[model samples]
Target: MTAGLLAPPTLIRTTRGRAVVLGLAAVTMAVEMASLVVGRSIHIGSQPLSASVLPGLVLLAALGAPSVGRAGDRDRLVPFWIAMAAGLLLGVALLSRTGDLADLLGLVVAAANEEIVYRFAVPVVLATALMVLRVPTRAARVAGYVAAGAWWVLLPGHQAQTDGAVAMVTYASFAVISTVVVARSRALIPMSIAHCVLNVITIAHLRGDITSGGRGALSACLLFLLVGTFAWPGDRPGRRAAATDDGDQDLVTDTVIDLRDGQRPSVHRGEDLTWVDEPSEDDQPEPVGAPGDRRSANHGPPRH
Candidate 1:
């Protein structure tokens, strides 16, 4: 049987990864404190920076999120900015409809937490793990985002009407939309902008609105979004890789001259090998050494 622990996988940690993790830490602390002070009460009102902060957060992220893009390059900035602009327009429209700019502003801030939790924390963690497990990067990022969504949904005291449903949609969107934007822009600017603006609009539209089935719908939508995002063919295929041991342990293949009647192939060092399909008493031809053998050819017969 194959046996031995593999080395820990390596990850190309990026600024966005740090932002996501750090951002999550900040958000969790802020929300927990907000929870303690508010106690199941979420204030929904208009604020001055509702329109501005979202843009500002995008700008700030623009300065750092480029490295997270594909090939770790800075190619995706323009489209990302455009998406953010579009989202900003949508947010303003929703703000106009709901007349709750303050709540929208709050959403902008709260939405950043998602970046921390999913865009940042979960992706980084999963990417790191995948690097170790040799999982495909595309698969890793998508899986990571979905995992983060599940984590948020299951957090304690998450209200279905207020937090649960809303969080589900917002986080689900973040997972897919961010992947798309980052993939295209190779920069976080556009995606962050889109994210901020989307939250603004969502919060604005949610203001003074109530529906009974929103919770179930939100939960279902979250699951659906996660599945679709992962299944989508956005990410590039990974490179082929092979493992090698140090210089002293060059691999050697051996043929089976004999088997114990019913010996079967088994795993060794994470590889599989098959023995010759012949009975032990068949008395195979005399074994001969071809290469890499230190022992004499006239030695004992090969065993399977």
Candidate 2:
């Protein structure tokens, strides 16, 4: 069931279908944005429930929901583990300096929600829209990813930081890398983890946990860059193996069918032939002079 939601949408064969998908995505985004606004306004025990919890729940649901069909390669744990490790190290580094539990919680929630919205949902919608508009598949995909990443970077909520250019570049780079991972790998979990790491690092940096000249900052950046390299689908060792296995299975199935069909006897006539009984080896031949044999008996009258 979880696999279904992570699957890609069915190809839009008809223009009407594409339009409907695009329209639905647009409406959903609008509703989500509205909810975010309302959630931001309300507070619960000094924390906004909508801002912290609601988006995460929504993302969780999306992740679990069924999709049209499985797309891309099967899920691999290597990339996920790599991302988690990087996130953990970066998160620890950030948390150590800030030592604020609320900030940590906030960053966690933001990571999940933002990744779902910007990396997963938006790019998918835009790609579908572009395909519907008759754009080439590769071009549509690239455009969708780039556009979604750019949107996240330029969002007003994300812009409330110092050094506008640096913030923009930093977040935008993260967005692009995350989006690429999602696009190539067709899996959100890894990128989401990476995003969370970025959020933690950024928040820590903003809080002056890592100064401009700090080595910790440089280490975080390098670790993140390592995480980004895993975004490419070809980097997974199991991917090619999985593809090869699928091909082999297909070939075997086809061969079996062909062999079975080819070996079947062909009928030359329109109608089936009648069955004829053959004498068995155990059966005795009819007696030469049985009671019914009149020729063997002496005849009283002879032919004149």
Candidate 3:
């Protein structure tokens, strides 16, 4: 598997994808720093860093959720949702030491900002560009993951202490999981909730006392789960469904509706389109060609 993955096309595409996503993430980071500076001056707060950073994270997630979610929709949403709910309950009980609920308040802002910045905006933009540039999926996935983690590390005090470090790790871990889950599920809602739940847990933990060793173990477990989930056969979402002569597993991508919630599906470049061409009043039917037309014969039979 390793040798095959290192073939020429794969190597070149992976390298290119890494570079593209890295470059985009670097630029986005610069913009975020500038925005933080601007936002700080215009605001009043003792914890200005938190104030500045949380909103940035939220906006990034919001911007990217649709596309990322679409990519992840095929996965088992049940496990993802269960993980979130359980994580949330544990987080509230163990992490939120202040018990004031306000300590968790910063979390709301953080979730919004981080999801957009790390999960949605950065991944979608970078991944799309890399894929367009013919970057290999493996490389694109790695680059996007690293870029998101880098964004977390660069946060104001993300690296300053053991606690901050722990929080950053779990928080970033959440993003990583959400990305995979989102791509696998090919639907955004569950992953978005998962992302939010992860943040809420981190915030709660910040207020409580969790041993470093325990944190490390938990991180390891989550990371393991992420890898395991992605490795499962056809259980994940991707640039397209399983490729075959028949294309039996193909999904209609052009206009995926968010059936999980009432929200309309956001469009992405390469999703299945069979779902979109359904007979809606707004759709314009293709013209039937002349009797001798080869085009009609080649248009092929409509997929079920």
Across 1-304, the per-residue lDDT of candidate 2 in tens digits comes to 1123233232122233333334444554565567656644334323343342354444344434212111233353455466567666776665666565555555665566666666555665676566556565446656866887787786656677636677577677666666555544444555555566666655567677777666356546644553445444445555345435332111111122122232222333333421122234555333354344455445743355
Mind giving the per-residue lDDT tens digits that candidate 1 earns over 118-210? Answer: 444444455445534645434655576566555554444333444556667655554565554433323333334445664544454466342
Better lDDT candidate (1, 3):
3
**Clash number for each model:** 10, 1, 36
Overall lDDT per candidate, in order of appearance: 0.40, 0.49, 0.44
Q: How accurate is candidate 1 locally (lDDT)?
A: 0.40
Q: Whose TM-score is higher: candidate 1's or candidate 2's?
A: 2
* Tens-place lDDT digits, model 3, residues 142-252: 576567667765665555543755667655655556555544433343444444554554544564555556655654555444444433435444434542221212111
> Residue 193 in model 2: shift from native, Å?
2.3
In model 1, how large is the Cα lDDT of residue 278?
31
Write the number of the candidate with greater TM-score, choosing between 2 and 3.
Answer: 2
Residue runs of model 2 more than 4 Å from their true location after superposition: 1-28, 35-56, 59-100, 215-229, 232-304
Output the number of the TM-score-best candidate: 2
